[model samples]
Target: MSSSSLQLPVIQNWSCHNCGGCCREHLIEITEEEKRRIDKQGWTAADGIATERPIIQKIGKGRYRLSHQNDGACVFLDDSGLCRIHAKFGEPAKPLACRVYPYAYHPTGEKSLAVSLRFSCPSVVQNLGSAVTDQRIELQKLGNQIVAGKKRDHSAPLIHRNSVHGPQQVNWPDFHRFLKAFDVAFADTSVDFVVRLMRVLSWLELVEQSQFQTIKGDKLNEFLELVTNASVKAQPDNDLPLHRPGRLAKVMFRLLTAQHARHDTEADVRSGLSMRLNLLSAALKYTTGFGTVPVLHGSQSAATAFEDSANTSPEQHRARFAELEGEFNCRTAGIDELFTRYFRVKIQGIHFCGPANFNTTLVEGFHGLALMYPIVLWLARLRAVRNNRSTVSLVDVQTALATADHNFAYSPALGLKSALQRVSLLAKMKQLTSLIGWYSR
Candidate 1:
């Protein structure tokens, strides 16, 4: 099927500014075909390519990835922050994955595709450059390549699956109905951003418990309205009832946050056992939630990208977890608009659930996504405190979102059974909203 029917996000704008962070931070796995093409390119010492190792390395049995240079960048990355492959050959000659950075395409219907941006890129997080809708032609071509051989018609991802319901499936039209409801709920600007999320969470519990087989078309819309209105009635205004996350919740969250804050670049991998040991120590500190917050190495990409390049003395390296707990005055129109855009993009692209997330049900997936608010705010608070500022700014939030989202759906550790359980447990203990409200203080 042709990828002519592409749905681009209107609220977001992105264009790569050649920060080269993605090239350094990500290990690009190549297909056998791509590896063979690179081998045939006849690279040598004269081309500035490393001669010590083959351009491709075997990661596992028959699994291969591009090699990194001594400075921990893709072998194709040049000194001027450009891809050697693109300069030598063409953009088409590069690996498909290389061409698809910052944009994620997923099947929204049999013939249509939805594009979601990865905020790991500073350009994307800042919403800088041209509007995404204007790039439909290029994105459509990429979408065609992505879904070239894949099935055109795919079954909709399950709505809510569990021991009680076994597995629940809905038609694509009805599935989109639920998505529309989500979009509308999030689009409501009458309430505070966090309150809007809390309202959705309040009703999503009903979605988890209720059967959806009979909820179709107008019936589904009515059901959604009923539940959403009920949620608003429960909590009318932004007078959020804040409660501290329980000790267990805090420990689990800190560990998870620590994972998000890490940088698993090829450089870190090449450091070998010593790097692993340092990570182990940091993990221990996060688990205890005492003393100083460990200086997670990869967490500073945002600071590096957004902050003045000449600021040598960064204090985030010395912040304590307790220091992040103090109020940073997180609520503001600008901040809410940033989150609104972030959440809408995810929802509209259906990027929070199904194959895009960790194969979680709708409720579970949204809960996991909601957890990002606190995590991002907490990291933003850390960034604020590091700079000797008592309040968080949009830049801090942007940096935190970029850093935390690097692992959001891409990290293998986050998809594990234990990680999934942490989200569920937080919701069960009624700590999810608590964390959101408390951290957004």
Candidate 2:
């Protein structure tokens, strides 16, 4: 594949600001080749790498990752919040994971790869730096490395899969039709973003039930339009109906939210039994939905990275879980635009589902993506109340997004059967929309 065939999200801009958040937050696993190369780099304690631990730690049989310092920063990350390896050995000398911090490449066509940004990076969430389209040369280089030795022929994920119907696969062209429909649906600025999400969810139900065996090209586009129009007729405007999620649904949603909110940095891992116990306790509190919300550790880095002024210590104002349920007026133009860009990037880059996600069918993965709106808003609400405010500022949403998304598709727990079931159950019980409405205030 040539760099000319690479697809980039024009709506997004990103340049590394050297916040060092990714270095602190992520455990970078290296390929066997990368491991041998790093070893050859000959990092030592005299080079300011941690002396107590080996620069690369064997995490499993024949598997290795860059070790972390006592404070949880990557072994190569220096006091200046830059990669030691990159400084000594140039950019290409760094591991592939190190070089590809926020960019996720999904195989879109036989010769093309679509690019998506991981919102966990503060710069990505804030839409900073040069436009992604402008970074074509650099991204293409990385894309080349990613596809260097890989098979060129890749199959598109099933459009709709279930136990009853098995799998509904589509050709790349037809698959792209669905992506176009999704982009169009979200691109409509006339509707509230939440309402747009609701409409999509309404139509995806139709998509799941209908087979795409004969539907291709124009016919598939026509079918999408009919369902999308029906969804508009059903929703029409922002006069969205509200229904509070049932008790069981709320409990499940909170647990899911807790998973996104939880931070398991290497420092936490090094804490061993106590860290596990604390997580267990936090999970229990989330399950019960009572008392003060257990303070999660990850959001502060996001707040710091974005320079959020309203960011007071969450510990000082530990909020009751009940407080987050209140109205916070989340539907602003700023927020809508932000979410639109986020969703469009995901849709265009084929990041929301398919192989980029956890091998979920299109409808199933979309439902999971839709749930992020509520989860983000809900977390934003928590930040607002904790800071002694009734309304959420755009920064609050930004910080919250950067926080929760750190685990979005990357977390092992989120890919589990139970986590996926939570999404299905909420959508089935009609609680997903309610949760969106309730949290959006």
Candidate 3:
């Protein structure tokens, strides 16, 4: 494996559908070289980019990035959801980051770079575009430019944090073994994806309890196989027990979901007392645990649902939730396949953990990844309620997923120590499983 040869998720496929969501949603930071090149190209109002505010603004004393228009679109982004640079000077003239909107590249091994796609893109959420594997040449070329002068050495990922055997760290070979086992278990189509997640949690529990200093090479593979079989026997197929989260746990989950579903793309604003007060007010509602779910960007359906439910009567919200108790868990080929490809892409691209996350250990990271299921389902249920439907649709899931994923790994609030601690605490209290079961309905 080498950085020059991109490692992509075989199970996932993506292509830009020119929706322009990325341009609208992200602040594009450019490099010194990129800034210089753009300066040389000489963009102006004639190019249709904003000139009132400098097209490029200094982010720091020396760092700069493209500025956004008053309406919040990137200056380089045209009205048609196209890049002005691409339309004018060609794709190569655009910044590297612009060229790689949904794709994230991470150094996986000494000489390898693993590829992952962001679910924030609507097309990506819908599994639109070409197969990821088929884009090897273009991705490799992109990879080359990304790592042109980068070094080959990379740090090994953490397997478990503060386990009974102490923190577990392994070389690339052992790390890859764990990833392979995870990929296989997660991709199993025989059972629901939620059940597969529960089983992985069971398997990781075993791994954490063992003395993994000697668990290497073929022994690790054997250990994974044994644990997988044991977990299968214990959980069985479609045999999950219904467990409701405690009231306190529900409050905690509501708060966590509020944080996860938050979309912070506001124009830069100075700190003020009013902003603090508004945050405090929102916090109060999040802690209440029985009100309308907090509104979020990219979550129009959910917000509309909550708004409609909230105004009608308190019973409306409760009745909607009651409706979910029976129908939420049902699965179909289309809905099931989206989650299948989603988990596989995360596992295959190594995007759910390591440096890509908030430096979480593999076990902790998996816990966060598993939570996405319930979070998406909760939001999807809200969408169903909005549409006056009892069952969740594929579009409901996609919209819900895109909304939650908009913040998942990218939100600063989620990367905080307190947020990470909450995830760990939920697992210990058995609330994670309860939430999973309840949401699975």
Best-performing candidate as measured by TM-score: 2
lDDT of 3 by residue, 1-441 (tens): 234556789977788767676776677888899989999998777777777788888989778878877656788878777888888889899999889868888777877888988887777777778898999988888888888876654777688866457878888888889889998897788898778888998888887777668888999989999999999999989878988788887777767777776654424222346556766676787687545444334433232322323223444433333444456544667777888888888888888888888888888888898888888888788767756678887877887787787778778888999889888898888889899878876
lDDT of all predictions: 0.84, 0.86, 0.77
Comparing 2 with 3 on TM-score, the higher-scoring candidate is 2
The weakest ten consecutive residues by lDDT in model 3 span 302-311
TM-scores, each model vs. reference: 0.95, 0.96, 0.91
Give the per-residue lDDT digits (tens) of candidate 1, residues 124-166: 8888999999998899899898998776547777888766977
Tell me the deviation in Å of residue 284 in model 3. 1.8
For candidate 1, give the lDDT: 0.84
> Model 2 clash pairs?
none
* Tens digits of per-residue lDDT for model 2, 87-158: 999989989987887999999878889999988888998899999999999999999989887765478888
Tell me how far the alpha carbon of residue 401 in candidate 3 is from the true structure, in angstroms, after superposition: 0.9
Error of 3 at 349 (Å): 0.3
Query: What stretches of model 1 exceed 4 Å from their correct place?
Result: 1-4, 151-153, 299-303, 308-317
Q: Deviation in angstroms for 11 in model 2? A: 0.8
Residue 298, candidate 1: alpha-carbon lDDT: 51
Q: Tell me each candidate's RMSD, in Å, in order.
A: 2.0, 1.8, 3.7
